[model samples]
Target: MSALRTTGLRAATGVAASALALAAFAVAPASAADTTQASVQGQSQQTAAKTQQAKKQRVFKVRTEKQLRMAVRKANKTSGKDRIVLLRSIKFATGKNSKGGAGRGDLDVRGSLVVMGRGKSINAKGVDRVFDVRTGSRLVIKRLRLRNGAPAETESGGLIRSRGDVQVRKSSLLESTVTGAGASGGAVMNDGGMLRIVESRVRRNSSERAGGGIEASGGTTVIARSRLTGNTTGAVPGNGGALHLTGTGSVKVKGSLVANNTAGAEGGGLWNSATGDFTVERTTIRDNTAAGAEADQGGGGLYNDGGVLTVRASNIETNSATGAAGSGGGVLNNLGTLALSTTEVQGNSAPRAGGGIEANGGTTTVVASTIEGNSTGAAPGNGGGLHLTGAGKVTVDTTKVLANTAVEGGGLWNAAAGTMTITGSTISGNTASGAAADQGGGGVYSDGTTSITSTTIDANKATGAAGSGGGALNNLGSLAISGSAITNNAANRAGGGIEANVGSTKVMLTTLQGNNAGTAPGNGGGLHLTGAGKVEVGQSKVHDNTAVEGGGLWNSATGTMTVTDTHLRGNVATGAAADQGGGAIYDDGGALTVSGSTIENNKATGAAGSGGGVLSLGGTLELNGTNLNGNSAPRAGGAIEVNAGTADLADVNAVDNATGAAPGNGGALHITGAGTVTWANGRIAGNSATNEGGGLWNSATGTLTATGITFEANTAPEGPDAYNDGGVMTVNGAVILPGSGI
Candidate 1:
């Protein structure tokens, strides 16, 4: 009091003296002590003392609950260089009767707050959120346990709620529940901003509407190397129990594990609607299930509707959906583009169609993926491995379609008006059993136009009590096979290798061998052509196949067959007997033409039967430069037997063949109809019989010609018996032999 009073009095007196001096110097009148000047001098002195005190830098420690809150708030509003509020081992609690209540307490900070302790628990008695960030503020939550803050049933509580950008890295959000009617993001919610979570664990989080673990509406979200496990929604059953992204939001998940996430509807792992782009790379979607109490639910691992789904180097296994008609046990693509590369879709089963992958109205490109051991259980569905029903183009290249079972097209079934092109792939070991009388196509069944090139259709079996053909493939429409192999396939009734009936089917350079058309009463062991069916074989091999009549090929009454430069050898027709010949070839009631070909070493080993090498009944036999040799028959015509047909042989040879019973009764060539036999420039030599006419026996009122013909070394066992005539020439013909011998 003594020093302060003296300084005030001295300072006032000095100001008065200076004013009087200025009055005297300028010859002015004195003014009433200049009271405004004296008052300004006192204020200036007091402001100087306060500025000196503030520069001392005070250190305020926060130990009590109220002091900690005031320190955090003071640091938030300050704008200095190092505005930091330090809190060490402080115990804070919000009471139930407080102003903001226990549930409404938060440590709001706009600046830095260093909280250093391990056993510190800030209990907000019952609040909706522990930390809330306002707009245009950045929040970095690091190494903090942001758990349930309240026990109030009315308000849903979570760890962090932000309207701006929130980055939570190396943090754990545990045991938090959001329990409101339209509440989402039980643990963390990013309303309309970007959220990045890396190396974090989000577990035991619950939501009511959607996104039990984390939900992002219309922003970019990135989750990398995080574990989202055992998260759930409330009683209403939410979608994407781990992560639900909707409303045009894009999410890029890399190297994350989303396991044990359950939903009431679609997308047990991740659900995407509203045209969102979701990319999952090197991730695992496992042990997730969708109950599907809602309508039209799908995707046990991922449910994508009208979005782009790219699964690369990922494993989507052991996921299930229990809806009424759920599809795609691994993935369901309804109206989007699905591109899968180097992925495994295995051990999946569907109730409707496409056990591994189902595409209804989208374009699916599968490259270098394995679709194996999948099934559609007795649902009258198609394509156990993949089903394409709607009108879309599916291109499958270098994919393994193995061990898949279906009701139709065991490996692939394409119905409706869709187009499926399969090249350089194998469709093997697949099965299709029909319910009623017709189960067609064991490996692949197409009701549309299917063009198969350079593929193998092998080891497939179709078993129907009334099934017709094609153990490996069945086509009710147009089917073109070029440079493909259809071998080692068996059917129940007919067309053991391939059944092409009543359709515009063309097979070129396709080998049909080792095919059996069962033991039933149909034709065509290698191929069955009937009902205005046309088959043309050029430079193809149809050998070692078995059927009733046409062993190598079965042609019905209305079936037309043209074979050029083709070999039909070692085919058998063991119906009741071998009398129905054509071991090498059989021509039913149709027009047959053999030109520039050979039908040899075929046997009709039936008793008193004919037509061993070539059998032509009720059809025209035109042989031009054709050789029918080394064929044997117990009856007549070892090389050829023509009944009710015309035999036109030009430069043809029938040699080293045996036929008939006795002398003059059996010959190498026997013509028994009102047919004309013309041998222009060929040899019928070395043909033997027990009777006469070792070369030929024409007895059914037919005209024979032997111009430029030679018959030599033909032996009749009962020779010189007067009936044995013309070893050089025995003919009921206008015989004109240039050179001949006996």
Candidate 2:
């Protein structure tokens, strides 16, 4: 032939060597939009080859175990990779010889085989397994039912055992049992092989040790659209009633259900260990129980040890850890990482701590999740919703923590040096109640550093005689809160919002409102500070707080308290008077500084009440660039009652302070006991009194030194502006209005 004719003929026939070389260049080229042009043609050729392979496929029909074994052996001798075994009703009976699904007693595949059952089932009748894959073999089984395969005397895998690889679809494994020494995997066991299950059921299985449904080791397993129900593992110290994985294997479960499973130790549904990784999506794990006898056993739904677990769009509900000291009813994460997105954990319970989740030593992250309706069973149990400890970091973003109950920390407890961050979350409607004392923090308890931002904590309660109550938080470590709201919390004793013990607190751009402390006599309705704890408030609000003493704040610390750009208003101090009443603040032995703040519209309404704004007792109180106005008292010192303290007031406003309709003294400034009050460059105006000393009153043993002070429009029935009775008062550079002096 001519050369031109030869080239044209080679191009016409697509199997030419030069044409195939050009096909490689056209496959997945960069800078090309028609990406699948060569791949589509190549796939067509591969499909033609597969069609030819299908011509070699053969089918065998069997009705008994002996016939199935002969067929499998014949298929292995001939076309082992392309043979199908069709099953009918095989009523395999119980035999006297004790051989469990091995050698010639079962349908053992020595090579690749396909099992297809068209409306047929296999009744093992407590004899042997229906299908078993040997070493170096592959199996595919579909549309089948396997039942009543019970193995005895330390042998595992009552129904199916795979030493190679398997792919199962639309099948059922039911009523299987493995009871002996260390017997496990009542339904299926994969030993160093890959497994894939689709649209299958594993039910009513029991194991003497672990994994009542499935167990996998040293391989990869994937299960989708499957169901596992009514399975149990042992009666004591057995784990993973549904599934278990060990060694360096991994599992992924999607669109599955694991329900009504029970375990005696931990992981009633699933367990993963030995550096395995697990991922679950769109699944449900519900109504499981872990009923151990003693402590250190938990995880009614799932557990991970020394591994990583990730879940998305899942639900864990109605699980329980019913032992004496069990914990983590929903999930137990020990030395592992847990990441959840859009998950819900509800109606779970534990006997000890962490009714919803417990994390130890590894990081846990929750994004847009809900944790609700969980509870710790009784006393000596804390953290009803969640617990974290031991050098782990927990991050919760846009989550809801609600309606949980415990002895302490009804919502969450971060204990022993863990770090936690909550952002854009809501924690509400939680209750903390113990039998007696030593219970507090209805919302959260932190023994480490806690950071909160843009969060809401409301409608929480801490009752039953807490020693020093913290209805929202009891912080023993550093706490930082910004752009948050703390409202409608109640405490039985004190500190309805926050209590800081031996830690520092920093709050900025936050609100503390509508909180109550104690029924009749309490302290620090908004906040309390004791021990070596310090507080700093900037750009914050403390309002509508009710207490018996220190309605807004109480500081009994020897440390420093700094307030800047803050507001304290609409607070009340009520009930009897023995040392009770400071409508805004009661300072006791602290270096207190207030600057750029407003203290207004507060009241001290008790009998013999004092200091409508502040009661200074043995502290260094300094006010700079502050406003104290419109405060009312029933008895004495409508604005400030100095019992025993030293105060320096500079650039401050003491205005509209009144002792309305009461026989009291010092509508603006009053000093009793051994204390010195020094006022510099301030305005004290529009004060009214029903009895004596409308503006300034100085008693015996009280010293007043005034400079650049102004007193205007103050009225009284007895003293108009100033009443000095046997007290040392020295005034310099003072400005008195024309009709405002006494």
RMSD of each: 14.0, 10.4
lDDT of 1 by residue, 240-356 (tens): 777777688788777888787766666767776657888888888777766563324556677776677777777777666556676665676667777877777776666666666
lDDT of 1 at 296: 43
Report the number of the highest-lDDT candidate.
Answer: 2
Query: Worst ten-residue run, lDDT, model 2?
Result: 24-33
Q: Which ten residues in a row have the lowest lDDT in candidate 1?
A: 1-10
Residue 522 error, candidate 1, Å: 6.8
Using TM-score as the measure, the top candidate is 2
**TM accuracy, model 1:** 0.66
Each model's TM-score? Answer: 0.66, 0.88
RMSD of 2: 10.4
Candidate 2 accuracy as TM-score: 0.88
Error of 2 at 629 (Å): 1.6
Q: What is each predicted model's overall lDDT from 0 to 1? A: 0.61, 0.76
Q: Which stretches of candidate 1 lie over 4 Å from their true place?
A: 1-218, 226-247, 256-265, 271-274, 287-297, 464-472, 520-524, 529-539, 543-574, 577-742
